[model samples]
Target: MYLRLENISKRFNSFVANHNISFSVDAGKIHGILGENGAGKTTLMNIISGLYQPDTGKIYLEDKPVKITSPKGAIKLGIGMVYQHFMLVPQLTVTENIIMGTENSWCLNLRQKQEEIAALSQAYGLKIDPAAQVENLPVGTQQRVEILKVLYRQAQLLILDEPTAVLTPTEVESLINILRQLAGAGKTIIFISHKLEEVINLCDTVTVLRRSKVVATTIAKEVTPQQLAELMVGREVVLQVNKSASVPGKVIVSVQNLSVANDRGIPAVSNVSFQLRAGEILGIAGVDGNGQRELADAIAGVRSIINGKIEFNRSCTRQKIGYIPEDRQKIGLVLQFSIAQNLILKAFKNLPFCHHFLLQPPAINNHAQVAMAEFDIRATGEDIKVSQLSGGNQQKVVLARELAGEPNLIIAMQPTRGLDVGATAAVHSRLLVERDRGAAILYISTELEEVMAMSDRIAVIYRGEFVAILDAEIATIEEIGLLMGRGTGGRKSAGTG
Candidate 1:
C-alpha cells in the first residue's frame, strides 16, 4: 500500500530527533534511507514501526490517516520491522519463533506448524529449516528467519534496519536476492543501511535525512554514491581511503607458529606465523568467528595462547601497545567513566595523570580537552559520561584513549563496525596516521572491502590460518575470496608492500 508522512516531528526532552519529516513511498517498490548517525533515521523508523508516537505529524496509509500507538496496532495494520539486532530466542525453533504471539489457542500442533513454516520459507527462497533451533543456524540464516517472521504475519510494508550489517559477503548476496523477490511479489519495503552501492542497486527510490530533517529524496538510478554520501552528511564526505605509501621499518612483532583457543577451549587459531613491521598496516580479512578475535586477544595479552610464541621487538611492552577491541561498548571504554577519566585509563598511574599516588583531575581533564578537540568528539563537555554520547562520539573516545601516546603497536579490531560513513573515515584516518608514526597495526575486520582498502598487505584468513598474504595493490578480490572460503585454494605468497 502507498504510505506517506506529513510534518512528522518528535522530541525527547529538549532534543529534537525528527523535525518536519515528509516523504511518500509507492507500493511494490524498495525505498532506501540514508543518513549519518544521530541523523534521525532510527527515530523515523521507530515512528513508522509504531514504537514511538510522533509529537506532531500525520501518517497516511493509502491516503488515509491512521493512529499507530503500539506495535500490536502496527502489526494489525500490516506493518512489520526487522531491526539490526536479531530478536530471536536462541532456544526456540524457527517455526516456533515465526508463529510467536500469533497462536490461536493453547492446543498447538508443533509438527504441523513446522511443515507449514517450512513451506513459507521455501516459497520466499529463504531455505531455512523450520524445525532447527535458532542457535544452530548461521547469521544469514537467522536474518532470513527474521524476514520470514514478518512475511508469516502477512505484513504488506516491511521496514528493515541495517539488515546486512552482520552478514557475510555470500550471505549478503543471498539477502539481496531475497529482498528483490519480496519486492517483485508486490511487498513495499523500506531498506535502511550504510552501504551506498547496495542501496543504489536494490532500491528504486533513495531518501536522505540529515540533522533531523529530510534533505533530499531522489531516484536511486539518478544519483551517485558520492552524491548520496554528501547529502546524508550535509558535506562533501570522502568515501575513499586516503593514505600515503608505507615505508616499512624494523619488525615490531612476530608470531611464530602461534595457536589460540576459543572461550570453549576449542582450537580456533591453528599454527599461524606472521611478522608485522613498524609503519605498516597488515589487515586480516575473513568471515566472522574465524579466530580473528582469539588471535587478537592473544596478541594483546588478554587471552592465553595454547602454543607457539609471540615476540615483540624492543620497547614494545604491554603498556606501549594500544588495543582497540571490536566490542567497543564493553571492551574499549568504561561506560560509567567520564571522557577525562577514560582517556587516562591506560596511564592513570603515570606522571602527568597521577602524582604522589593520587589521581590528578586537572591534568586528566586537560588531556581530555586536547584529545576531544583533536579527535573531533562532539559532546557537551569533557565531564559528560561516555554512555551519554552517540556511537560515533563514543568510538572517538576509545580512539582518543588508546592512541594517546602513539603506541608502538596498535591492535584495531573492527574499529568501525557500527559507525556511520563519516565516523568510519575518521577511524581510518587515525589508524593511517598511527601507521605513519612508526607503529605497526594489526587491523582485523570481517569487512572485506575495508580490509583491502586499509591494509598495505592483505592476509586471507580461513579457519584460523592465513592462507595467503598478498600485497594490497596486487590482491585480486576473487583470489582473496577463494582463499577465505577454501584454504590455500588461490595461494598468493606474502608480498613486500
Candidate 2:
C-alpha cells in the first residue's frame, strides 16, 4: 500500500467523528472515499493531512509508521491536500502561490519558479497563466493552481475534498482526466465527493463511509452508481425525483433587463430576462463564478442590481424571500450562535422572542425545538451552537429555519453540494414539496445531475450569459455538457428545432 490508515479514531467533545476507520490506497491508483456530508470524510482527510491529530490510530506511508504532527510534516512526507475551498492568497500570483511554503536558497529565483510552474501546468494540461494574480483567475483555473501547488511540492499522495463541487461538467471532466493522468504517473490519489457518477467513472477502488465509520471498500468497476449510493447511505435510495409534470402558474417573479457588475466592475449578468412562475422549480446551471451569485443576490434583495426590474407575486410580496446561500459558513448561519438563535434570524424582527428590545430565550428555544422536530434537524439540543452540528445537519437547521417562515419564494444555491445520499434525497423531496405547494424556487447548482433531476426547466449559464433553456425531461448529460462548454446547444437542440 502507498498509504494506510488503521483504526483511526477522532472525537470532538462527546461525539466520535471517526470511529476506528481503516482504509488503504495503492500507489499509482485513484482511491475514492465516498460518503455524505458530515460522514467523517473531511475529518479523515484532515487527520491524514495533519490538520487534526487522530485520537487513536496508526498511519503508514510505504508501510512505515509515521507521525504527521503538522502540515509541514505532511508535506515532507509527500502528502498534500487540496481543500474544498482553495487556500491560495488571492493577491499573489499563481507562481508565487505555488511556491508559498517552499524554502529555497538565499538567492530566490523568481524566473526559475515561474518556469517550473509553467512546466508543471503544461504537464498536467492545466492552462494557467503563472503571472496572473489568483484573484483574477476564474474558479476552474484557480483550482488548477491549487493542484499545481500540491504537485510542485513533490507530493506523491494527493487528498482532494469535494473538488468538483464548484466546477462545471466540463471542468469536472478535465479534473478527472488530470487525476487519471496523475495516477498513471505513479501518484496516489484519495478523492472525496458526493457525486456518485464521478466516483463510478474515475476511481479504481472505493470506500464507503457513514457516521464516521467505513461501511465497505470495493473495486469501483464492481459497483454501480445506485449501489455506491446505497452503500454510502446504508439504505436503498430513490436516486431520481418522482415528480409529475409541473403545472407552472402565472409568473410569480419576473426579472427584466437585469444587469450586474462583478467585483472588477465588469458586467457579470447582462440583460438577463427570465420568469419564474408559482408551483415550478427553475434551475440555473452554470460554471462557478459565472454570475450565479450576483443573480441570486439580486433576486433575494441582498445586493443592489446595476439595472433590473423584479416583479413579485402578491403572495410572494407578503412573505419574505428565503435564501440558502452557496457558502454556508459565510452567509447561511452564524457559527457562534446557538441553533435556537439562528432559527429566528430572519423572523426576529417581530416576534414574542423579542420583548422590550431584547431576545427572549424561552420563546426562541421553544420555536427551535418545534422547528428541529419538523425539519428533522439531528442536533443535541436547541442550546447547542450551530457550529457543533455536522455540515448536513447545519444545512438542515438552515432549511428548517427558512421553511418555517413559509416563504413564497426560495433561492437555493448549491443546496446539495456536499450532502450525502440520504440528506440530498431529503432536501430534494422538501424542495419538490415546496414547489408543489406554490412556492417559486430558483435552484442554482453546478452539478448537472442535480439540475436535471430536480428542476422543472434547466437554464445553462456560461461566460456570464444565459445560453440555453431546456426541458429537464428531454435533456441529456451530453447535451448539457456541450452547452456548458461551447454555449451552443448540441444535437438535442437541433432535433428539437
TM-scores for every predicted model: 0.94, 0.91
- State which candidate has the highest TM-score: 1
Our tally of clashes for model 2 stands at 2
Lowest summed lDDT window (length 10), candidate 1 = 488-497
lDDT of 1 by residue, 1-497 (tens): 48999999999999999999999899889999999889999999999999999999999989999999988899989899998889999999999999998998889999999989888888888898899999888778898999999999999899999888766676788899999998888889999998999999999998899889999999999999999988888778889998899999999898988999999999999988899999999999887778999999999999999999999998899988899999888899899999998888888999888899998888889899999999999988999999888889999999998887789999999999878889999999999999998999999987788998999998877888878888898887777766765666765577433
Runs of candidate 2 exceeding 4 Å displacement:
122-136, 262-266, 349-364, 486-497
Residue 173 shift from truth in candidate 1, angstroms: 1.9
Q: How far in Å is the alpha carbon of 151 misplaced in model 1?
A: 0.9
Q: Count the backbone clashes (under 3 Å) in each candidate.
A: 0, 2
After aligning candidate 2 to the native by TM-score, how far in Å is the CA of 339 from where it should be? 2.6
lDDT for model 2: 0.86
1-497: candidate 2 lDDT, tens digit per residue: 89999999999899888999998999999999988777888888888999899999999999999999999889989999998889989999999999986856788888888998899888877788899999888777799999999999899999998898877677888899889989998999999888788888999999999889999999998999899888887889988888877988877788887888777778899877788888888888877778999889888887778987888877776355888898787789999999999989877866788988888888998999998888788887999998887777888888987777668899999888677878888889998988998888999988878888898888887777777778888878888877876678664321111
